[model samples]
Target: MDEPEPERKVNGMKSIFEEEIKKIQDEIDIFKSGSPNHIAIISEPYSRVEHIYNRILGDNSQKINNIQIFNPVKDTDFFSNFYSNQDIIMMQNCQYLFSRKCCGFAILEEFLDILFSSNKMYITGWNKFAWNYLKEISNIESMFQEIITVPELNSKTIMNLIMSDVSDKVTFIDDRVSEDKKFICFEECLIRMPLSNKEVNISEIKFNFNALKRKKNNKTMEDIQKEAFMDITTLAGGKYDVARKIWKKSLKDGEVRLSRIPQPSEVEISDIDELFILGNILAMDGIDFDELSSIVKNDSLLKQKLYNLVNKGLIEDSDRFYKIYPEAVNSVIDELEKNRMVW
Candidate 1:
């Protein structure tokens, strides 16, 4: 597992929406004034949730020295030394409290019951997918008085963030401009994919993250994606994290032109059982390798499927926890449905 992120990285150095920060501050102000209010900050995994928390801390640290932050997933001393003077408790990774196939909150029920029932102002960060799952299964959303989700990025914002990093190598070339059609192009280069000898021509364009899979009104979800740009954000689906990963991957050979948009993946499911298992993994957001293995109940078969999925670039392994690749998540969902692996 990755070590805890350094505090300097999250201590109000990142830019966040002023209006959203103001709203959070308002909620905190109300709670401090003895109002029954609590806040839940849910964000996309790897997105900018901590920056928001830091912004709140930057603005209020002097007034609330009794505040303490905890990580429910890793911290062991949280419950043992709970102090009554701690009026504000910020907990990160509250999603770890729930388990897909475990016995009753995995011994986290008491901690949560106590944390939520306290009179303090609780600002907890949660994974968006997990929060949604819990909201559906357990009505977990009802516990929070205010919910704030991380804002999606726009093409302009993405361009600003990326260009700042690789400005020396990139040049935004305008291909064609007219009242009827406008095209923004990028400098191109040939780069070899990792573990492959074939050098492919490519060009990279920074796009908004939110546009990754968003469909236009009345448009059918087509198998083949057309080359399109929306205010420069069309390809990314408004997720800056996804765009950054793509850019970093493309920067190995001094900056390759983003020549191709990622195509839909066609992962092979070897059997009915494999198909069902893949669907279950996706439906559960993601699962640990061990958790998935126990559910499948066959060491050899589970290992084989994990190998196949990872090799196909449809599944990812991060610290033994596996999930469908972000780029392939929607495709896998659709493929599973087409095969009737899931309803």
Candidate 2:
């Protein structure tokens, strides 16, 4: 499924960099001690990797502070009121594409240019194009302290450059052979990391489901619908209404007791059409209003009932769409699948 783009704004590039610089400065202040820590932060807009970074920086005890720089054109609301620190420096990583504008790459290049001209930061590595640019503009070897990139050179080439006052720190960090470039699986990378350094207890930051349920129960609706509209009630209401209807039908048939809420063992699978709807929804990739309408097409009775349950919070609008809450779906499914109906 295609994902929707975040809201946009004009001149988003300028705003994005400005925000990054501001956030970097703010984070520095928050983490800065007499002795500063060296931190590296990286993120891509499409990946949820930034969430991990956020969790890391939010640890008040950690010495490192980092920020993910992005082009705000895609999502203008994303970086508002970000962390305030002055010790952090922002760098943009950019790449080129034939069809679309590479905003991130452009911004990174711009920042690098300004930093280099002001002698604020040293260039550690460069591809051929960047190396040529530096050479044409100035004596690159004399200008920078180090160069970390992949290239072949003899001892004579190095000696000659140094004799011409072109010596700088040059080293190769990659020792891989040309033919050894192959795709590495995620598991391989995980195995390489030290297990002792990994954080095993992540429950501290995770949301408590029980706490969320309590909060939901406490929220009082300010107004109620004038009539029992299919779409007007909460998901919980829809489930209650469906259960009530089933209960009444069973009573009329003299098959079950109305006073006691019938357990799963007491009810037959065939009697729970609402349960079937729930199952189908739980199976769907993303249950939205449109998907539900498509599934219950022309069946106003089912649609209205389901909508009411959603409105009443009996079933939740999980994932902010027409999809049934996963918890509700699982509960209903478990009941239908039970061997001992009442048990």
Candidate 3:
């Protein structure tokens, strides 16, 4: 009888864990199914749109009927072929809608004008530049039945734009989520369409309080990120991206550099986990550690593993605390992949 009590307690805990697991599973289902008929993902050139696409389709077994529109309808055949293709059921008419690789506001405005003129729903992606430019122009804002914005970076200009138009007429969906890509419902006009005045007032009051907190936290993250990259106009300095490319090229070069050949005594294998941690830090230099920690605390375990490697002579630490162990770096990456640590 005493053992049964313990077993019951264990079962109770298991049930609670199972409930949480179910909640997450339900959320995932919402993510896959709740994706609207049309979505506009304003993203940068190298943004994570592909990652989003992969998550929606791969996880949920849903297909995005896409019509990639980079530059405007340069070739009528291209546009015609895309629209005419009926294979795209989920995405009735998806288009890239870009004038060039890096088209700015003028290009996006024209895209809105086209949307306003038509009733067909479409999915498009734009960078932060294009999103802000569109936000500044109110005429463009009224054109969309629903607007879902995914913030890639924290920019004041962008935040202000988000605050301005996230209203009743528009449903604002925030795609910043914990696991994988998620869409957070900020404002859903349809929900309040039939509510009474008192109900609407109460909802508005509650929503305002929540919005204030969201905005404050969001702004803080943005400010911290901005401070880190203050020196690099293009972002922490063009050197960060450049350095990454150099490192990758060096790795794939097939032969170690004579300059990189470490003496036997100097060579040591550092922690594999540290490689990912250091790789991320190196990817975008000038980011503050405080901000990085807030975002990547899950990756902190690599620090201890990395310290062990330093003693093994496989890795070396720079005066700046950045690790420079060649063999350890390679091993860490391999181990991370082997263990499926990457998302």
The most accurate candidate by lDDT is 1
Across 1-343, the per-residue lDDT of candidate 2 in tens digits comes to 2221222211111012233333444545544333433222222111122222333234321333233332122332423312334333322221110001233234334433543444122112122232333345445345433322222222233223222332333221222233323322122122223556563422223345555554465422211111111221121122322322432333333223222222232223343545555544433322455445544554576666676667644356645454534224324435535732211
Give a tens-digit lDDT track for model 3, residues 148-193. Answer: 4443332333223223433433222222332312233343233443
Per-model TM-score versus the true fold:
0.64, 0.20, 0.30
What's the residue-level lDDT of 229 in candidate 2? 18
Report the C-alpha displacement of residue 29, candidate 1, in angstroms: 2.4
lDDT against the true structure, per candidate, is 0.59, 0.33, 0.36
Model 1 Cα lDDT, one tens digit per residue, 202-319? 9876454334333233232221111122322443456665666655554445533334334334655657766766665665556677667656778798888778788888778888
Count steric clashes of candidate 2: 38
Order the numbered candidates by TM-score, best leading.
1, 3, 2
Cα miss at 301, model 2 (Å)?
2.1
Please state the error at residue 59 of candidate 1 in Å: 3.2
Candidate 2, residue 212: CA error in Å?
A: 38
- Backbone atom clashes (below 3 Å) for every candidate: 19, 38, 14
